[model samples]
Target: MTNEQKALITATVPVLKENGVLLTKHFYNRMFTHNPELKNMFNMGNQQSGRQQTALAMAVLAYAENIANPSVLIPVVDRIGQKHVSLDIRPEHYIIVGKHLIASIQEVLGDAATPEIVAAWTVAYNQLAGLMAGHETNLYEQQTHKTNGWTGWRPFKVGKKTPESAEITSFYLYPADGGKVAPHQPGQFISIRLFLPQLNLKQARQYSVSSTPGHEYYRISVKREKGANLDTNGMISNQLHDFINENDVVDLTAPAGNFTLAPDIDAPVTLISGGVGITPLLSMLNSLVENDYTHPITWLHGCRDQSVHAFRNQLNDIVKTKDNVKQHVFYNQVTDENREAGVLEGYLDISKVPSLNLQPNAHYFICGPSAFIQKQYHDLVGAGVNKQHIYFEEFGPQLLSLN
Candidate 1:
């Protein structure tokens, strides 16, 4: 873009800050109305919660702010690229999105969206779209080239569904074609798409692969999200828990995520989780154990109580047999039995436990709610852990700022 175009984009920063969500909301509504079929590819739960709109708004604002050197956003781009690859997003889809986005900006801005302003945004959008398309193409290529890997969506059948907790169930998914499945990186996730009868449209959600890699089937532990009364936040999860059954087929996109454990790392590893966020971390832990990791490993988990803590027996077996592994459990609602079991009351505070082996060179992986992640990240940084060594995974929108 020309200097004037870049300046124009930068000038819209204030407006974007004030009404960015409004613009994105308009864009989504407009796009969905015109291209209803695309709804199958999006997380309607996020749309209803307004998370997708807010996330997109922030991304657009960031792009505009860094128009002169957008390469600085490569990390953010790569993260989004992984998500896009999992959703099977293609270049053609970006063209549709760009059209609706530019139209939404014009409509939201009214007469203020002059031809020059619209043209500038068009160029900016195209540039971003090109960058994203290129990155996603490479990601797709990587997936296809991997052994037993394929692009787009593949049919998978639920081979087994085991209740891990009162609210969480683990589904073992096997390829419907009876072919070998691609081995995913520990800590990665797969996109599962299902049709919702009430909404009359399909919805997709990314669930972390709970089991270790190199297995014929992938396992995803899902928590039935019973939201507030009449809330749609848990529709997909609720449907999966209530309706999905063994042998039922579902569409699954290939595994894609940047949050992965380096298998060759020979340092102390600490895994921390709160509530249902243990899914991905559990995969990392299992992988480490399978590889016979000799480094000190600490498992820290927090939940309401033992009843809601998934994988208790499995974790217990590991704790009992693995001398290199140590664990500490925190319960929000503890009982006398819990006290006898050595469970701590209240939230997880690493400072309170000195046995976590907080070595300066050790790596820390955290997964949980946004607030949980924020607190743990801040606490770890404050406790002298290097910012680069601490990685986190948060479900839903990517709004948290680790920096």
Candidate 2:
């Protein structure tokens, strides 16, 4: 974009900060109305809860705020690229979004949107769309080139459904084509699309792969979401829990995510999780154990209690057999037996555990709620852990900026 266009976009940062959600809401509404079929590609649950709008607002505000130096937003771009590829988002979708976005800006800004300003925003949107499309193209190419990999959604049949806890259940998905599946990075997720009869539309949700790679099937442990009154936050999850079953078929995109463990790294590794966020971390931990990683490995988890702690026995067996593996469990409520077994009560507090390896060479991976990840990140940094070595994955949109 030209210097004048950049200046215009920078000047609108305040507007974006204040009214970005309003703009994005308008954009989605307009786009969906014009192209109803495109709704199949989006998470309608998030759309209903306004989470998608809020996430898009933050992204737009961030872009406008850093219009002069977009290179600084490379991390955000890469993260979004991974998600887009997993959803099978293509260049044509970008064109649709760009058109609706420009029209939404013109409609919402009204008289304030001078022709010059609109022209500038159009250029700015095209530039960002171009960058994101290019990045997503590369990701799609890489994913399709992987062993047993293919682009777009592939049919997978639910081979088995096992209850992990009161709230969480594991679904083992096998290729309906009866072929080998591509391996995924330990912390990666796959996009599963299911038809929602209530909305009479298809919706997609990304769930972290909980099982170790190389198996004939990919496993995703899902926590049934019970939304509060009038909330649509867990529509897809509830559908999976209530209706979907073994032998049922669903469409899924290949695994894609940047938050993954490096099996080759010979450093102390720590895996931390809260609530159902343990899914991806469990994959990393299991893969490490399966590969016989020699470095010291630590697992820290926090949840309600024993009844809700998924994979309790499996984790216990690993701790008992692996000398290099150490486990720490924090419960909101504890029993006498838990106290006898070294289970700590209350939330996860790293400071209370001095025996944990805090060396700079150690790599820490955390997956959990946004607040949980933020607190863990700050605590790790405060405890003299290198910031670069601390990585986290948020279940929803990428909102937290630790830097």
In model 1, which range of ten residues has the least summed lDDT?
A: 226-235
Per-model TM-score on C-alpha atoms: 0.97, 0.96
Model 1 clashing-pair count = 0
- Model 2: per-residue Cα lDDT over 215-273, one tens digit each: 48899999987646432337788888999999999999999999998757789999999
Give candidate 2 misplaced runs (Cα > 4 Å): 227-233
The local lDDT score (0 to 100) that residue 281 gets in candidate 1 is 94
Tens digits of per-residue lDDT, candidate 1, 30-94, equal 99999999888888778888989999999999999999999999999999999999999999999
State which candidate has the highest TM-score: 1
Tell me how far the alpha carbon of residue 105 in candidate 2 is from the true structure, in angstroms, after superposition. Answer: 1.1
Give me candidate 2's TM-score against the actual structure.
0.96
